[model samples]
Target: MSDNPKPTVEGGSDLPGWEWDRTVEDSEAVAVGDSVTFSKDITDDDVVRFAEASGDTNPLHLEDDYAAETRFGGRIAHGMLVGGLISAALARFPGTVVYLSQDFEFKGPVRIGDRATAEVEVADTLDGGRYQLSTQVLVDDEVVIDGEAIVLIDEAP
Candidate 1:
């Protein structure tokens, strides 16, 4: 969400392999048809960093042997970690997007290294520049997470 054309890390270096797209060219004209999609590979580093940052060291997401014994049969990315992609999509909106709230139902597992894509579309425009959006994350065309979100899109200062 910085004014940079590409997402950057702490050093202002571009985040490798991260890509996004939006249907609306004029970010100022956000409407029901406005939509954005963000894609990136959920790497091993992503899982570990997320686990450390979120304090969700669930064995299913960290301990390979322990995960191997479970129904997933291997380590899977944390549900919230995958859900965070929705936030990524929202950040691409033209304005200074302020997240209001989000609800998610994780539908499947995303293994480390899976290319996860999150798509969000404006479903309705509310009063005061707020929007209700339909949100979902997919892996290989399979919906791994489904949900909705509300956000306030404010003008860039």
Candidate 2:
């Protein structure tokens, strides 16, 4: 949302190889057009761990042979797993970001080992410290998921 982007925070994650950047310096200044980006690479361990945690052990995401036969041509990451990146982006916001609702359209497949970047932009200011954000996840500079989310940003207590 910011044309002149400034790095409010960089390499904010404690996890290895994870990174984030916030366009606005003040996280408490939740306004229309504020944006944040979070990036990480999807790895084999991530997929297996996500499957074990979420119970979404679909063969297309886990079985290379099965996935190769499908239209995707190879194993692909879970859609929701990639969508979760949007939440990762929101967490970089200046306050406690609570999600009320989110809706997503999976436009394309995200292969394992791809670097996924989630971008969240505050599209509109809502009543009661809430905001509507446009959320997107991209792999290789191609949008793989697009969505909208409503979140309540509460002051850090």
Candidate 3:
């Protein structure tokens, strides 16, 4: 992680539909040692829609009986579905963001009606203009999944 603290906007970067500018000079700041958390409740409809849209019809996420037989003992949401929300947050933040890679570790099952929170912390900065962010998804204060994401932001134009 590079220790340089200056924020600049790249013109004509690789990210599509994004114009990087220093509109929010502190947008990228991680407050030295603070973490940023974004949370939302998971509804049954959310799970069903995600399953339908992603074409992942795993019975464990839809069939209660089948899910009950599993270790979770109930239906759970698709891991990527919860992950997608984190991606959405990163994209909406004030910057030209590009997801480079992600490493996810599912800690527990995420059931419908559980309020999940996604937290991100600026972990490191690479020399190649990439940001390594520490991310996690939690339910009822229990971390359901955690991972690290690599994002690239270049000058727009």
Candidate 4:
């Protein structure tokens, strides 16, 4: 599946009221140990929108009452939402990138209103225009999600 040029994503958000802090484009170069990042402020609005889109209405991610009784103590954001930030970071790559695979471990919960940063560094390279990246999402200096991804880069059309 990683070998395929196109994945299933059809578009990105152009919704009003939400904004990215920074947009990095046309970087110097991508080499081993180089990195890319994208950060966003997680809001209740973001959580609700994700739930509606993903059909993951687990109370742990929605109702405050239900989540307060659980280990998380309050409504928490979806783990995959954080992963999407990692995808956002990867999209900043110099060229078009198609995610081949991702391995993730959810180490901690992301509470509403928390600011999360996704950092991905080039760990190594494989044959046939592939790169292996070390991926991590941090919330206030704590590692919340960690993983690695294999991506295939295509020259821009």
Which number leads on lDDT? Answer: 1
Compose the digit string of candidate 1's lDDT tens values, residues 70-115.
9999999999999999998887887789999999898999999999
Q: Which ten residues in a row have the lowest lDDT in candidate 4?
A: 1-10
lDDT of 2 by residue, 38-134 (tens): 8999998999999999999999999999999999999999998999989888877876789999999999999999999999999999999999999
Ranking by lDDT: 1, 2, 4, 3
lDDT of every model, 2 decimals: 0.89, 0.87, 0.69, 0.78
Model 2 TM-score? 0.90
Which runs of model 1 end up more than 4 angstroms from their true locations?
Answer: 1-4
TM-score of 4: 0.83
TM-score of 3: 0.74
Question: RMSD of each candidate?
Answer: 2.5, 4.1, 8.5, 6.4
Q: State how far residue 107 of model 1 sits from its true place (Å).
A: 0.8
For TM-score, the strongest prediction is 1
Which residue pairs come into collision in candidate 4? Answer: none
Candidate 4 ranges with C-alpha deviation above 4 Å: 1-29
Worst 10-residue lDDT window for candidate 1 reads 1-10
Between candidates 1 and 3, name the one with more favorable lDDT: 1
